[model samples]
Target: MSYIRGYDPETLRELVDARECKDRLDEIGEQRSLPALLERVWLLKVLGRLEDALVISEQSVRVARMAGTRKDLLRARILHASVEQQRGAFAVAEQELTTCAAEAEGKGWSGIAAFALQHRGKVFYDAGDYDAARADFKQALFLRQDSGVPDAQLESTLHAIEAADQRRMRASVAS
Candidate 1:
């Protein structure tokens, strides 16, 4: 998401508006696909607007409940956790991720479950609980190893954890 280019500040502002337009379907009583809602939420997330993302995503979660699609609910839950993480609500984010992962574990969505674990690990890392973060990361790594996800992204995530650990250690030494 961060890799996408040409999302200049002006474009981001416009995009934020567009996403709001799509997100307010209740005003028009016009139906929107779950994917459409998710896309808007994702764009808002990439724009670094976590509050907006949370608003739209919570609406989407309600819609998903009405739609009664387990998969859609799963996606919404994961995305909601991600937005909370972006807002630095680490405990709330971890709770959401943990709930989603537990549900996914029983429903044969281990890949999605693993993704939730990554989010959980990130929250733990940001909260400076690296022991818990390492456990979550190790579990996620094992899942990804068997699940055949693209290795490059996982490698980058691992490296991010490593870098954060290094920084924390340096800060401790300096203290």
Candidate 2:
């Protein structure tokens, strides 16, 4: 299946008001489709409705599994991990993303694996584990390059790796 475009939760959050985004997501989520549900899950996460987002994220995973599309399943799993990360359950989020990354790797889905690693890197980043985050982001960048992902997508990970490196250096100096 072709990737559905323009459903990035962070982008949407910045583009629209929370209430308006929620209303639109609610309408779209009525279908319970993978993309719609996942988008809603992300928006709710941004809105700080962790419990609701978790429920929907879990549902998206289940639905995506039933749908049997590797990309969708991976994306749903990644989003679930992201919600956990947002809830400050960094360990759980890392574990979830680790599993997803392993599964994607096993399936030879490099893009999915890269995406999972990128999110796992984010989990580590949020926990102030800059070294680990840098490692993950570096690996993710390699994977994205191997998989021929867009340069636009790769740039953020590069920036993140640099930022992680800077943070690590600063922390070491401070200590």
**RMSD after CA superposition, every candidate:** 6.1, 4.4
Error of 2 at 75 (Å): 1.8
lDDT scores of the candidates, listed in order: 0.71, 0.82
Off by over 4 Å in 2: 1-20, 26-29
Best model per lDDT? 2
What's each prediction's TM-score? 0.75, 0.83
Model 2: lowest-lDDT 10 consecutive positions: 6-15
Give the poorly placed runs of model 1, Cα more than 4 Å off. Answer: 1-31, 171-175
* Candidate whose TM-score is highest: 2
| lDDT, candidate 2, 1-175, per-residue tens | 2122332322211233666666766677566777788888877887778999999999999999998587788899899999999888998999989999999999899999998998898888878888998899999999999999987678777777877888889899999
